[model samples]
Target: MLRALVIVPTYDERENVPIVVARALAATPDDVHLLIVDDASPDGTGELADGFAATEPRVHVLHRAAKEGLGPAYLAGFAWGLERGYEAIVEMDADGSHHPEDLPRLLGQLTDHDLALGSRWVAGGRVENWPRRRVLLSRGGNWYTRLALGIDIRDATGGFRAFRAEALRRIHLGDVASHGYCFQVDLVWRALQAGLTVIEVPIVFTERVHGVSKMDGAIVAESLRLVAWWGLRRRLRAAFELVVHRRRLRSVRANSSRVV
Candidate 1:
């Protein structure tokens, strides 16, 4: 049996942790384990997770000293799973935006692809309870990200995803720099660059009903800036490589002409 770990990062999500954890465990296969990565949520989210872990053998918790951001929390969770010999690692949101019932579908797709992304913009995918402006922003942001990064994924910023351990290893998780929502986009980009196959699974995204949203203007701006910077860097590196290749070809032809 391939062992899988569903990593849920939480911060001040005291009200929703138990429900999400229960649903995730119920939806996953027997081999799938759940790990709650809590950033020392002052709301006692960590305590709630520990309570669950005490009774459930499949559930575990990693309590961080402080809120270091989503990226770091996930990194820590991934490392925890990797060290424990899990073959697949899943990324899920604790606020219930990502449905645990869809976990089986996402993990099933991982059999043929290196990554399975639960996307809201794909066919049969939809969002529930989000206002028009929020929907438009998500759509436009994904469009912009695709244009900038040249990735064909419909929901590059979606948080629900499953990754094969080998694929994650290939991407070198330690070098990931995004500490916000852009972290999703960064991982997708790196996985593609490493020549891994990525597939999207349609999923319904729901607005959180229990707690405050973590999204902020600063996080959005940071995502935009990082995407633009990465795009520029990719272009510059390609241009430099082209120049170098042309020079080498010209030098080779010149030598051939002298020999002739």
Candidate 2:
């Protein structure tokens, strides 16, 4: 049996933490463990996670000093899981947008692929309780990401994802600097760049019933800026390589003519 660790990052999630923990534990096998990465939320979310950890052997908590963004929280969680020798590491949201029931399906995909993403933009995937404007925003962002990065993934921004430990090792987690939703895209891009196989599994993403959304204008602007920069850098590298290839071909032709 593959040993897996599900890393859930939490911040002020007092109302929803227990629900997530219970459902996640019930939904997966005994070998699957839960690590709640709490960002020292003022509402005592960390204390709640500690209570669960005490009673449940599979449940553990890592308390940070402050509320860093989602990216740092996940990065820390990944390090914890990797150091502990888990064969698989999973990223999940604490507010219940990512269904614990779907964990089995995501874990099953690791048998063949390096990464499995719970994608809302893929065929057969859908979101519940989201407004039309939110849907459009998600779709548009995904579309733009695909076009800019020239990748085939349907939902690069989705937070529900599973990673093979080997894949995470290859991804060079030290280089990842983006935060918020952009962190998701950054990982997918890095995985592809590392030649790792990635697959999207259809999932029903439900809006959180408790807690306000963490999304803000700043995060969105950062995502857009980083995506565009990466795209531009890729295009420039491709053009430079093309120029070098053409120059080499011309030199070869000239040398052959002289020899003739």
Candidate 3:
């Protein structure tokens, strides 16, 4: 049985936190675990997490000093999952924007792929309760990312995702340059560059009903600029392709040279 660990990043999501956690636990099979990385939310979320941990053996929490954005919290969670020998690691929001029931569906992709994205922009996916403006903006952003990154995956900024342990190992967390939602896009690009299998699963995204949205113009602007900057860096892109090529070449040459 594979040991799957779902990493939920929380910040002042007091009302939504327990609901998300409970739903995830109920939806997932026994082999899966949950790790909540709280940013020491001012609303006493950390204490709530601690209390939950005491009763639920599969639930654990990591409390940071303050809000550090989504990327860093996920990185911390990934490191924690790695240290504990988890076979699959997942990322989801604690605000219930990401459906807990989708966890198994994402994990199922690892049977044939290295990463699975719960994509709202895919053919069978949709978004509910988002203002028309936000919907258009998100679609446009995703379109820009796909064109710039030259990747086929939908919903590049989607946070609900599952990674095969090997895929996670290939991604050097220290080298990730972006934070917030852009970080999600950058990581997917890296995974594809490494020649890992990437799959997108359709999902309906709904705005969090109980908490304030963490996304804002700042996040949107950062994502646009960062992805564009990545696209414009031709030299850097070449270097990245070269590294992947060299790695593949070495593996091929080593296999051919072996005396069997």
Q: Considering every candidate listed, which one attains the maximal TM-score? A: 2
lDDT of each: 0.93, 0.95, 0.89
For candidate 3, the per-residue lDDT at 104 reads 85
Query: Candidates 1 and 3: which is better by lDDT?
Result: 1
Task: Give one digit per residue, the lDDT tens place, for model 3 in 9-47.
Answer: 898988988899899999998999999899989999888
Query: Looking at candidate 2, what is the lDDT of residue 64?
Result: 95
Q: Where is the poorest 10-residue window by lDDT in model 1? A: 1-10
Pairs in steric clash, model 2: none
lDDT of 2 by residue, 57-114 (tens): 9999999999889999999999999999999999999999999999999999999999
Worst 10 residues of 3 by lDDT: 229-238
- After superposition on all CA atoms, what RMSD does each candidate show versus the true structure? 1.1, 0.7, 6.2
Candidate 1 stretches with Cα past 4 Å from truth are: none
- Candidate 1 lDDT over 1-260, as tens digits, reads 35899999999999998889889888877899999999989999999899999999999999999998999999999999999989999999999999999988998988899999999999999999999999998999999989887779899999999999999999999899899999999999999999999999999999999999999998999899999998888889999999999999999999999999
Error of 2 at 9 (Å): 0.3
Give candidate 1's TM-score.
0.97
